[model samples]
Target: MRATIAPQDPADNSDWDVDGSPPDVVIKLSCPNAQPAPPSEEVESFTPAWTQGACDVLSTDLLSAPIQFSVIDVDALFDDPIVSVQYQVTRADIDRGVMEFTGSGALRSVAFQLTTYYAE
Candidate 1:
């Protein structure tokens, strides 16, 4: 499955240059009763950015699982998460091709694509 994530305009962009430094972007995903996918790729020191990432999940029944996405900032030595959201996916949503969601408060909006087949 693939998820394209980024900060949603003003809320996420407003603090782009926090303390005169760019925010390091990180995305994470998890599913209940299944091994979590490796954290998504990170773009170091970015401001108001978007990222496309994919993970290979081995679960046989993804429809029953709720996938969670978390967006965070990687600081000098710690990770500060901006938003975290979870959705219980169905086969229909995956077939639909595109789905959108948002994080709490200042977390950015996220768009994701689901597919059972992968193209090399």
Candidate 2:
């Protein structure tokens, strides 16, 4: 999913970078039914991880709720959120083992892998 991003954080409209340069981005992947997975690292335009992909392995139980994805700028003092979106994965998605979704807020572009295994 993709949406345009400005230099400021959409969450609070704060500076995204401290040094007056572009922000290095990170991806936060989570599901409401489970604890958030580790933050995935990425570089400029958040392309490194997004172009390739970030992965989080989870159980089918976690799929009960919509998937959560957020983009954040990695700051030395603190990280700030740029965008967040929630997508409900349906049985069709599980059966296909892949799903296509969209962005809801402030996202420029994003791709993350939610790996799940289930019986047919």
Worst 10 residues of 1 by lDDT: 1-10
Off by over 4 Å in 1: 1-17, 32-34, 44-53, 58-60, 117-120
Q: Tell how far residue 17 is off in model 1, in angstroms.
A: 5.4
- Against the true structure, whose lDDT is highest? 2
Residue-level lDDT of model 2, residues 5-98, one tens digit each, is: 5655666666567656667777677765565666665675533344333344455665667787777777777766676777777776666655
Candidate 1, TM-score vs. the true structure? 0.63
Best by TM-score: 1
| Candidate 2, residue 73: lDDT | 73
Residue 103 displacement (Å), model 2: 3.5
Q: Report backbone clashes per prediction.
A: 0, 1
RMSD in angstroms, all models? 5.2, 4.1
